[model samples]
Target chain A: MPGQTTASLPRVAITTGEPAGIGPELTLMLAMQAATLPAQVVAIGDPDLLSSRARSLALDIDIVPCRPGDDLPAPQAGRLSVWPVSLRAPSLAGTLDPANGAYVLDTLDLAIAACRHGQASAMVTAPLHKGAIIDGGHPGFTGHTEYLRDACGVDEVVMMLATDQALHGVAHGDTSCPLRVALATTHLPLRDVADALTAERLERILRVLDGDLKRHFGIVSPRILVCGLNPHAGEGGHLGREEIEVIEPTLNRLRTEGLDLTGPLPADTLFTPRHLATADAVLAMYHDQGLPVLKYAGFGRGANITLGLPLVRTSVDHGTALDLAGKGTADPGSLRVAVSLAADMARHGQ
Target chain B: MSQAQPCIALTLGDPAGIGPELVAKLLEQRDVVGKANIVVVGDRWVWEEGQRVAGIHHEIPEISSLAEARDQTGPVLLPTSTIKPEDVEYARINGLCGTSVLEVLKLCMDGASAGQVDAICFAPLNKLSMKQGGLKHEDELHFFVDHLKVETPVCEFNTLGNLWTSRISSHIPLAEAASHVTSERILSATQLIHDALIAAGIEQPRIGVAALNPHAGEGGTCGREEIDIIAPAIDACRDAGYAAQGPFPADTIFRRARDGEFDGVVTMYHDQGQIALKLMGFERGVTVQGGLPIPITTPAHGTAFDIAGKGRANVEAMRHAFDIACRMGRHHASR
Candidate 1:
C-alpha cells in the first residue's frame, strides 16, 4: 500500500514448499481468504496436494488449475488458482517424503520462471526441507536463497529478515516501520566469520542491500546501521580488527558513493531505540550478531526478504515446523505477512 | 562466622559519584541492615554527605577504627574521612576522594583477612579516579590478590540474578582472542565459575562453555578452534566431576542462559557474552571477582559521572551486588 499507485491488482506466485511440510497446509489457509488479498495470487504446487491439505484443514476452497500462458481470472474468497505440479507420492500430515522433494523444487522452478518473465509481480515461498531435498539426491543443496540465486544466475545476493510489529501499526502507509537485518556471513562458523568478511564482499552486500531497499521497499534514502564483527565493534581495535581492516573501509567506500551508512557500532547497544530510531536497515557481520536480537524482537511475526533478487521475493521467517505440519498448529502469521509485503513490493516496483 | 550474625565490611568506593549515595539509599532498607552486620568503611564526612545527598537522615552508629568494629544490625562507620564535601566537587575527580577509597579498601580487606567480617561488597568505584589519586593497582582483583597473597586462578565473573558468565580471554583483541583459547584456559574459567556458582549456593552448577568458533566451528569448516580447544576443555571439566557443557554458539547460548538453561556460561572472550548480558539486564548486573580468598563484588556499572550528585542513580545493580555478597558470604563462611 505504501507504493501502490496502480489500478490493477498485482499478480503474485506463491510456491507451496515441501508437500510433507506445513507449506501445503499454509497455502490452503491463504487460498481460503484469497479474495481479501491486494494482489492476484497464483499458487505453484500440485493441485491434488492443495485439495488434500484443504480437506484436512476443513477449508472449503475451489482450486482453479492454470499455467503461465493462461489469462488469470479475478480473485475471490475460497478460490485458488494453481499452477499444477504433480507430486511423486501422496503427502501425509506430520511426515517427510524425500521422494516428493523434486515436486517441491519443481514448484520453486515454475514460480521463479513466472516472476522472471513478469508473468507474476513477485514470489512468496513457504518453508522447505533442505535435508529431504538433499536426500532426494540433490547433493549440497544449501537453502532457498542459494537455489534462487543459482536459478537467476546472479553472483551476489543478500538475505534479510524484518518485522513491523514493533512500529505499533503506525506504518500503515509508511514503509519505515520494519527493522530489517541483513547478514554479512550466513551459516558459517564463528571462526570463519572473521575471515569470510572481506571489503569487496562487504561493499557488494551493501550495494545490493541499498539498491533493493530503495527499489523494492520505496525508500528514497536508506540509512543502514552496520554492526561490527567483533564485540564493541572491535572496541577501537582491541576486541578485533575486522571493523578497522574490512568493515570500516568498505563502509567508507560505500558512503562515498552517497550511501548513508553508519556503524561498525557495538551489536549489543545497536538494537536499542537510540540507534534504531532513524535506521532503515541494519547490516550485521554474522548471523547470530544480528539475528538473536532481531528474532527476539520479531520472532512470531517476521518475514524473510531476499534482497538483490531480480524480482521481489519474500518468505516466512520460520522453517518447515515439522511437528506442527499436519496438526493445524503452525502459525500462518509470518507467511501472511510475507505475502502482504511481497504484494506491496511488487506494486512498488511497477 | 562463629557469631550468630555475619558481619560485612562495606566500602563507599568513589566519593565524588553515585557510590556514596547508593550505599546511603541501600542502608535506608531495614531488610539489608538486618541481613548482615554492616560496618561501613569511609570518612564520616563522606558518609554524612551521602546521607545528605540521598536525603536520608538515619541515625547510624559510628566507630573510629577497625579495632572498634562490632557485629550488629546498626551500621558501624569506620571514619576514613579525609576529603570534605566543601573541598571536593560533587562530580569532579578529586585525589583525596580516590585516596579515601584506597584507604577504606585497606581497612576492609584487613578486617576480611582477620575474619572480622563475613564478606565485602563495595559500591561502584571509579578506577580512573583511583588512578588519579596515585593508586597504582591495575584492577580491584589484582589489588585483592596482592592483599590476600594467595596463589590461585582468579578472574571476573558477571551475574545478572541467577545467571553467571565467566570468560577465558578477557580484555584482549578479538583476533588474538582465538589464539588464546586453549583447553587449559577454558577448563580454568569453567572451574572457577563452577566453584563460584557453588559458593553462591548452587550445589551442582550447570555451566555452559561457549565455543570460540561459531556453531562450535561447524565441524571444523568455520574454524577448528572449537574442535581443537573448547570441546576438549569442556570434556576435561566434565571428567573432573563438573557439569560443564557446550561450546555452544555464543549468540544462541545467551538466550538459553537467560532462560535458566544453565547456571553459568564460560565464554571465549569478553564481549561474546557481554553484549548479550548487558543488553538483557543493563541496570541489574553485578560483577563478582572470582578465584579470590574472599568473595568480592561491585555494581557492574561504573561511576555515573554524568548523573552524579543529583541522587537519581538507579540502585538495582548495587542492590544485587549486595545480595550476591550476602549469599556468597554465607556460603564462603562454611567452606
Candidate 2:
C-alpha cells in the first residue's frame, strides 16, 4: 500500500478498436479488473459507449472522465480512466456501421499520438474490422499493423506474437513454451511470398526484431532462430534457393553486426524443445509458416506486439468478433495479456 | 476377420537401427499378439541380437520358407534373410545393412503381391545406403511405386494421434510450393488421402484441407491459391462422393482436428501441417504410405543412430505403426 501511488507506474492508453464490434465490450471487461496490472490504463473512446457496454455486460467499473489536458488518476480497483473521444455515430452491439470508421481511426490516432508525445508510456488496441473501416471510406487499410506503420512513419516494422505459457501435448509427449514468431513478410500472396522474401527485406526485419528484443524484452544477447522459406529449409537448396542464397547471406551479415542468429533451419523441426532451448524467438520467413504452430501452442492466449516502432505498442492477436459483440461471450484473455505486456514493456523498455 | 485373421508381413527396416529391437519388444504385448497373425520377415540372427540388446528373452518360432509362413502362424518370425551380429555394425549406415533392408522390403512386397500377407509394417530405412545398394528411387514412395509397377497414385502420409496430413507438394522448394498448388494436384492428393483413410477403416473420413497462405489468402488479398485452386478441389471431391472440407487457414485447422472435428487433413505444403503436428506430438507420429496397392505403415521417426543399441528408444511410434498396419490389413482384406 505504501508504494501504491508511486510515480514508477507507466500510463498506458487503451484504444477501443471498432465500435460496432466487441472492442467496446472487451474494454469494459478488462478495465473492471485493472488494479492488478503494473500500470494505469486510459481507455481512449466515447465514455457513453463504455458505460453502455458495462451496463449491458453487468460489469461494475466506475468510469472516471479525463479531458485532454487534465490530471490522470492512478489505476485502482473497480475503476478505469476515460479520455473521452466523441463517437461519429452511436455504436450498437452486433452491427456493422461504416459511418463510425473514422471514429475508430480517431481513437487509434489519439492513442498513438499520446504514446509518441509521452503522455502515455504505451498503447494497447482491441480488434477492428478492416472491411467496415474500408466501407467507411479509408483507402488501403490493411489492418492496425499497416496503419500503425504509416502512423509511426517507419520504413519497416516487425509483427510478433508471444505468450508466456505452455501446454503438454498428450499424444506426442510434446510441450509448448513462450514461443515468439516475428514475420519477415505478412499479408502477401502465396505467389508473392517468394519474391517478396529477399536479403534486404530479411535484414531489415532481423534488425528491428533484434533491437526490440534487447530494448523491450531485456534479452542482452538475443538468440533468434530463423525459419527457412522451404519445408525442410530448402533441404540444401533442393526445396528452395532462398535459404541457401538470400536468408543465409543476410544472417551471415547480421551475425557480424553482433546479433546471435541461428538457422535458416527447417521450419518443421525448429519448433521443438531441442532448438528452442537456447533461443529467445523464432524469425519465421512468412505468415502461415510460423503462426499455425505458435497459435496452436499458445491456444488463443497470447498478445501481438509491434516491434521497431518508436513507441511501445501491443494488441490482441485476434480480429474483431462482430457476431459476439453484444452477447458478452467473447474471451478477454488476449486483450488482458496485451495490456499487461504493454505495461511491462513501458516500465522496462525505456 | 472371423473367417481368417489378417496375416501381416513385418520387416526389419534397418537391422542396424532400432527396427529389430522394436519388433522384438512390440511382440511381447498380448494385444499385439491377439490382433493379427503376423509373419515377421527379418534376419533371425539380427532379431536375436536385438533381443540380447533389448534384454527380452521371448522365444519366437522361426520358419524356413514364405510358403510355410502363410498357413501356420500364431506368430512366426520368418527368416527372409540372415545377418550375423558380428558382421553387422550397430547404428552405422553401410551398403551391407542397406541391402538387408531392401531385401526385407522386397520379401514383404512379394508376400503382399502373392496374397500371402494382407498388409505390411516395416521399421525405418535409411536412404543413403539404400542408394548405395543401387536403390535408384529417390524416396521409398517412388521405390514402392516403381516396384509395385502400378499406375495408381501414391504418397507418404505423416500421421499423429488420430490425424493424418497429405501434402500437395513435399520435399520441394518453398518458392516452387505455390506453382504446385493447382486444382489437379489438390484433387489428386485429396483423392489419395481419402482412399487411404478408407483403407485404414474409416467409413467416410472427414478431411480438412489447409490453405497455402497465412489467413487462407485473406480472400485473395494475401493469396489466391485458396479461392482459385483449393476451393474448387474441395468442390470436386464433394461432387465425386467424398466428404472433404476446407481450404481452412492452416493455423487453426489443427485445433479443430484435435477437437475431433475431422479425422484427417490435406495440407498445401509439407511444413504447413508438419510444424503443428510435430509440435503437438512428435514421438507418437506414424508415417503411413498412403494410396499404395498394399497397406504399409512405419514409425514416423527415423533410426535413432544416437540411441541405437542403448535400449533407450521409445516404442510408442512402433506400437502405433503396428496397430495401424493390423487395422488396415483387416480392412483391406475384408474389402
Candidate 3:
C-alpha cells in the first residue's frame, strides 16, 4: 500500500455502454469492488441509470457525481465517481430502444475526450449493442475500435486480446506468460480475409503491433508469431498461395528491418504451447483464426486492448448480455481485468 | 466384449514418422493393458525399431494370427509384414512405409468387420506418404468410408476431452470454404456429429453451429451468410429433431462449447474449430472417423517426422485415442 497511494493510482474513465444492457450493472459491480484495482475508475454514463441499476441490483455503491477533469478522489469500497451524460430516453433492462443510440456514442466521445485531454490515463468500455446504435441513427457504426480510430483520426489501430491466465493446454504443458492474439484483419467475411491481407497492410500492421508492444505494453522487443492466411499455410502452395506470395515475403521484409517475427505457420498448429511459450503475441490472418483460441483460453476474463491509439484503452471481451442486465448476474471479471490492464498500460507508458 | 474386455487393433502409423515411437511408448504404459485387449497389428521388425528408438520395451506376446491374439489377456503382436528396419527411413514420405501402414489399417478394419476386433486406434500417420502409397481418396476418412462400403454421411470429429468439433469443410482453400457452407452440408455434419456422440455414450448431444462470417454476419450488415445460409441450416437441423443452436459467431462458439453450453460444435471451416481445439488441448486431441460402422480413432496430429526417431513424441494423444476407442467399442459391442 506504500507505493499505491492515491496520487500514484492512474485515473481510468469507464464508459457504461448500452443503457438497456449489462453495462450499467457491470459498471456498478466494478465500482463496488474498486478498492482492489490499481486505478481510479470514473463511470461516464447517465447518473440516473446508474442509480436505478444500483437500486435494482441492491448494490449500495454511493454514486459520487463529478466532471471529467475534476480532482478525482481515491477509490473506496462502496463509492463510485461519475461524469454524467444524460440519456435521451429511459431504458429498461433487456429492452432495446432507438432513442438511446446517440447517448452511447456520447459517453464514448466524452471518454475519448477525457483520455486525449490528459484528464484520464486510459478508458475501459462496457459492451454496447451495435444493433441498437444503428437503429438509433448512425448506420455506419461497426464497432468501438473503429469508432475510436476514426474519432482519434488515426490511420490504423490493432485489436489485441490478452489475459494473464496461463494456457495450461492440458497436455502440451503450460505457457509461461499471458496469451496475446492480435488480428491483421478484424471483422471481415471469410471470403475477403485472403484479399484483405496484402503485403503493404501486413507490414503496417506488424509495425503497429511491434511499436505498441514497446510503447504501451512495455515489451522492449516483442516476439510475434504470425499465422498463414490459408489452411496448412497453403501447404507449400498446393492449398493456397497467400503464405508464399504474401505472408512469407512480408514476414521476411519485417525480419530484415529487425523485428522479431516468426512464421506464416499453419493456423491450426500455431496456437499450441510449443509455439506460444516464448512468443509475446500471435498475429492471426483473420478474426476467427486467432480469437477463438484466445477467447477459449481466457473466456470471461480476457481484456481487449486497442493498440496504436494516442491514449490507452481497454474493454471487456464479451458483448452486452441483455438478458442479464440489471439482474446482478453479469460477470465483472473481464471489466475488472480491463481496468487493471489499462491502469498498468498507463503507468507503463509513463 | 462378451468377456467384458473389448479387443482393439493398434497400428504403428507411418513407420518412418514418430508413430512407431509413440506406439512403443504407449505399450510401455501399465494402465493401457487394463483398458483394452490390444493387438499390435504392424510388422514385428518395425515394432522392435520403435521400442529401440523410444528406449522402452514391453514383452507383448507374439502371435501369427488375430485368433491367437484373442486368446491372450495382455497385448500381442500379429506381425503382419516383415521388413528390415534398416531399409526404412525416418520422417520422409516413402511409398513402402505408407503401403505397410495401410495394410495394417486394412487388417484392423477387416478384423472389426469380422468381429475379431471391436475398435481400431492407430498412431499418427502421414497423409503425403499415404498419397504416395496410392491412397486415391482425399484422406483416410474417405478411405474408411470407401472401405466400410456403406455411408450415409461421414466426417472427421476432433475431440478434446468432452468438447468435440466437426467442420463442414476442411483441407481446402479458405476462399472456397464459404461455398461449402450449404444447408445440406450443415445438416449432414450436424447429423453425423450427433449420431457419433450418441454412439460414444452421450445421449442427446447439444451441438452448436458456427457462422462463416465474423460477428455472425452482424444481422446481415457485414455478411449475409449467417442469415441466408447458416441460420436456415440450423433451422433445418432443428426441424430434423436435433438439439442444435447457433449461427453463433465462429470466434465465440468454441468458447461456449468449452464451457459446456454445448457438447459439440459444427464449424463452417477448418480452422474455426481446429484453432480452438488444438489450442485447448493439443496433446490430448483425438480424431474419430465419424459415421463408420465400427469405431475408429487416431491422434488428431500427424507423424512428427522432425522428432520421429528422437523418441521425443508425446504419447498423451495416442493414449486418449485408445481410451476413446475403448469407450466407443463398448457401445458398439452393446449395439
Candidate 4:
C-alpha cells in the first residue's frame, strides 16, 4: 500500500559528491534502480560523469538536462532528471583533481538553493573529499553537516545515523519498532568537548531529535537515553564532577518539561540488547563515542540525517571511496537508503 | 618456611570514608585470599567498625611485621592508631582519622621498599581530608614520589584491557599542562608504557600517542603542539626500537585503542585518557603507577563520599587492582 501510493510522492534534490570518488558511480546506480524509490529525483552535478558511470555499469537510464531559468520538468520513470553545472574539465572517475573542486561546491550550492527556494522538498548528498576541497582554495568545511549549516544560514544542527528498523530494530512493546540514535556534541576535540557540553546544548539537541523522531518516523514521545561523559557517570563525582555538575542537572531539567528521557548511564554497557530494546534513541557524548557502535551495528547501510535544519537533509554514512570509484562496483545500499529517508522526511514536513 | 607468597600491602584510605567498608567487602571473597595475602594498613578500630557494618564476625590478626604476616590465615591488620571506633563518623573528615591514613601509607611504603611486600594496592584517599590533616603534599602519589627520590619517569596508567598512560604533568593548571608537554617528557612516557606493557607480556606492543591539538594541529591551523612536540617524540621512540605511532586526532584515537589497533595510549592530559578509559570499562579498570620501584595499583576511581558506608560500594575495581598487582609482582620476580 505504501509503495502503490504515487500521488503523495515528493520531489527530491540530490547533490552528487566529489566527481572523482564513488559518488558519481553510486548516483548512477541509484538512478538505474530509481523505479523503486518513492519520489521523483533531480540530480545536481555534471551530466557527463553520470552518463559515463551508467554506461560503465551496464545500466541504461534516460538523462534529462535542464538549463538555468528553464522550467523544471517532471521526472520520467527509469530516467534521471539532472541540472548540469558546467565544470572546467570532464570529471574522471577515481581521480581527484583540485580543478573540479569548484564544480563540487557549485553542485551542492545549486541543490541546497533549490531546496530552500521550494523547488525541491528534500536533499540527499554524496560524500565530499576534504583534501581536494581545501586544495581548491575554498575554506574546506569540517563536514557536510557544518557546510549545510553555513550554506543554509542556520545556527545549530545535529547529526544522526539511522538503519532499518528491521535489521537493527529493538522491540518497544508487543507491536512496535522504530529507528534511533542522536549525537549531542559532534566532531569536537577531546579537550574542548567538556566545555562545549552544557545543559542547554544537550537539551536543545535532544528536543530537536525527539521532535524529528515523532514527525518523520511517526513515533510519539520517543524514549531517549543519554550517555554520560565520564566513566560510570562520574561515580557521584569520585571520578569526575561533570556528571553531577552538568549532565544530571540537565536531564532533570529536561524531564520536568514532560519528555520521556532517562539516564547519564555508563557509556560502556549502555549499548546492550536489553537497553536498546526499550530506547527509541540513544544520545552519545561525541563522534567516536556513538558513531563506532552505530556504524558497527549498520555497517555500510547506515544513513546519516541532519536534524534542526529548516530543510530535510540526509546522506550515506560511508565516506567517498576514492579507491573504488569508476570501477562500477561501489555499493549503492547506503545512498539508496539516504534517498528513501529524505523522501519520507519530505512527505512528513511542515 | 614456605616461600613468602606475594603480598599486597593494601592501604585503607580515609578511615572516615568508604575505603574501610570496600576493603571488608573485598576480603569476604574467597577468590581474593586464593590470589594473594592482603595486609590491610589502617586503624584497627576502623576495621572492627567495617566488620560490624558488613555483619561479618571475623577475627582481626594484629601483626607487628611482614615476617609475622606469612603465618596469618586471614587478612593481617597493621593498626596505626589508638583512637576508638566510636570517635570516627561515617563520610566526615577528622584530623586523627586522616593522619592515620597517611601513617599507614608510609608504613606500607617502607615495608614495600624493604621487599617485605611484593606490591602495594590502595583504596581511594580523600585529598581534602589529607590537607585538613596537615599533610604537606598535593596527593598521596606525589608525596610517595618525592619521598622515594628515585625517579625514572614514574607515570600513572589506567588499564581496562585497553591501557591509557599520561604524558603531561597532572593536577596543574591547563596552561601549565600544555607547557609541561615536551619531547623529552613524551618520549619518556612512551618508553615507560612500552617497557611496562612488554614486561606484562605484550610482545611488540603498539602504542598510540594522542595529539595535544585538535585534528593533530591540522597542519598548524589549530595549535602547533602536536607537530612541533608530539610527532618528534613519537619519532624518537620509534627510532629506539619502540613501535609507537600517532599524534592522531584525539577525537578518534581512543576508538582505535578500543579496536585493538594499539596496545596502549599515551594521552597528553588527565581527562583525555580518564574519560575514554572510564567510559570503556569503569568497573573493571585499574590504575597502576608505572615506573615505581614497587608496582602500585588501585581502582581507576575515587572515594564515593556521597555513598560512603551505604553498603553499596562496588568492589569490582578494587578486586581488579589487587589481581593486577599480584600478576605484575610475579612478572617482576621472574625477570
- DockQ, all candidates in order: 0.32, 0.67, 0.66, 0.10
Residues B135-240, candidate 4, lDDT per residue (tens digit)?
A: 7764566777876676667788879874656555654423245676889888888888888888778888899988876557678766678777888888998999
Q: Indicate whether candidate 2 or candidate 4 has the larger lDDT.
A: 2
TM-score of 1: 0.81
Using all chains and alpha carbons, the TM-scores for the candidates as numbered come to: 0.81, 0.90, 0.89, 0.76
TM-score of chain B of each: 0.92, 0.92, 0.96, 0.93
Where model 2 places Cα greater than 4 Å from the true spot, the runs are A1-6, A67-71, A169-177, A256-258, A298-300, B1-3, B15-18, B39-53, B57-64, B71-100, B127-135, B305-309
DockQ of 3: 0.66
Residue-wise lDDT of candidate 1 within B1-335, one digit each (tens)? Answer: 32445677788878888888999998888788877778888887878778888998877787766655554547788777567677678777777777777778877888888877778899987665666676665466777788888697888898888899999876555556667788888888988998888776789999898876655676776778877777787899999988988878775788788778899999887677776776667688899989988888888876777788898888889889988888877776766
Please give, for residues A1-350, the per-residue lDDT of candidate 2 as tens digits. Answer: 24666367778888998888888888888876777776777899999989888888888888888965566776677787898888888888878889988999999999988888788999999988889899999877878988999988999999998765643422211122256679998877767888998788899999999999889877788889999988667655545688888999999998998989999887777887667666778998888877777667644477899998999999998888888888889988888888878877786687
Alpha-carbon lDDT, every model: 0.80, 0.81, 0.86, 0.74
Query: Tens digits of per-residue lDDT for model 3 on A1-350?
Result: 35678888999999999999998898899887888878888999999889988998889989989987689777888899999999999999999997999999999999999998999999999999998999988999988999999999999899998775756632222221277789999888888887888899999899999998888878888899999887778766656788888888888988998899999888888887778776888998888887777666743358899998999999998988998887898899889889888988898798
Across B1-335, the per-residue lDDT of candidate 3 in tens digits comes to 43477888899888899988888999888888888889998888888889999998888778887766566778999887634567688878787787887888888888898888889999888777777777887678888888889657888899999988898987778888888889999999999999888877789899999988888888876778898888989999999999999989876787788789998899988888878888778889999988889999999988977788997999999999999998888778777
Alpha-carbon runs more than 4 Å astray in model 3: A48-68, A90-97, A168-177, A298-300, B1-7, B30-37, B59-74, B80-100, B106-118, B132-136, B146-152, B259-263, B326-335
How close to the true structure is residue B84 of candidate 1, measured as C-alpha lDDT?
Answer: 69
Worst 10 residues of 4 chain A by lDDT: A170-179
Pairs of residues at least 3 apart in sequence or in different chains that clash in candidate 3: B16-B91
Q: State in Å the error of residue A26, model 4.
A: 3.8
- The residue pairs that clash in candidate 4, if any, are none
